[model samples]
Structure formats: C-alpha cells, structure tokens
Target: MSRPRDLYDDYTPSQQMTDAIKAWEDIVEQEKEVRRAAREAIAAELRDARVERDGVEHRVSQEAVARYVPWSEATVLGIAREYKVPGVRQAKKKAADAG
Candidate 1:
C-alpha cells in the first residue's frame, strides 16, 4: 500500500481532470436546459392539439343536434366543452368529485 499523501499540500489534480470536470458540468447544465425547454414545448403543443380536437368533436355533436326541430342543449346533457381556450387548469376538487 502507498503512504497517505498530505492532501493539504501534496494533492493536486491534473489539468486534464480539471478541464474534463468543467466540460462535464457545462454539458450537464446545457442538457438540463434543453430538456426543460422541450418539456414546455410539448405541453403547449398538447394543449393546442386538445383544443383542436375538442372543437371538431363539438361541431360534430352540434350538427347531429341540428337535424331535429326546436333542438336545444336542454334536450341533451348540455355539457359542452370549450374550444381554443388557454390559461385554464383543472382543479384537484374535480378529481375527488369524479371519484
């Protein structure tokens, strides 16, 4: 076994190790930023897609009801969904109510 060196005076890292550590840290931070950005972008895209799909589905139901005379939401469940809407978040209370 080798003798223990004085870490306070004799311990010195190679330049390569220092540089490698710095580069590794920079890369890790960059990757984290990219992942954060991608997650936000995906969330926005999903919200838009949901709104688009909801609009189409609502139109289909509206058309189906139009076939009848004096038709109104009162004749059905009347729970219409909103379209192209943003800045809306579902409450946790709704989950409890649903269950």
Candidate 2:
C-alpha cells in the first residue's frame, strides 16, 4: 500500500509555497491567542469555584459545630474568662416589672 502525500508536497511554485507558509503562520498565531484566552478564562473560573467552595465549606463547618457542640451562654462566659476577655452581662430588670 502507498502512503498518502503530505499537503506541503502539493504546492509547486515558490509564491504558492510562501503564501501557504504565511497562511499557516497566521493560523498558528490566531490559535495561540485563542488558547491563551481560553486558559485565562478557565483559570479565572477555577479561582471563583475555589472561593465558592471555601465559603460553602466554612458554612458547613460552622453548622456542623453548632449541631455537635452544646454551646451555652455560660460556656461562652467561661471561655471569655479563660481568655481574660470581658464577657456579655445580663440586663437589669426595669422598675415596671415590680408593678
């Protein structure tokens, strides 16, 4: 069986060869630009996806902790005390409550 002739073998004249080469170069340049743009767009989309995933993971972790941990005001106060930070105080009842 005979192998198929390459496209480069089809061009005969020097001018035709030069034109073909120029056309091929133009095509290659355009393709490179297109590929670069596509890669940049994909990278941006991936970054956005990562940020969204991080936000979702943070919310899920908070929800999981809230579900699993029995946190109370006293517990918060105790933590604050351990950290040597001021904690929340209870509001005093108004005199109207004595009526």
Pick the TM-score winner.
Answer: 1
What are the per-residue Cα lDDT tens digits for candidate 1 across 8-52?
876789999999999999999999998666545433443443323
Q: Root-mean-square deviation of each candidate, in angstroms?
A: 16.6, 20.0
Instruction: Give the per-residue Cα lDDT of candidate 1 at 81.
Output: 30
**Regions of candidate 2 where Cα sits further than 4 Å from its true position:** 1-13, 50-99
Tens-place lDDT digits, model 2, residues 1-99: 999967886656789889999999999999999866654443333233222342442112222222333454454344334445442233456799766
Model 1: per-residue Cα lDDT at residue 27: 100
TM-score result, candidate 1: 0.45
TM-score of each: 0.45, 0.38
Identify the runs in model 1 with alpha carbons over 4 angstroms from their true place.
1-8, 50-99
Model 2 C-alpha lDDT versus the unseen true structure: 0.49
Range of the 10 consecutive residues with the lowest summed lDDT in candidate 2: 57-66
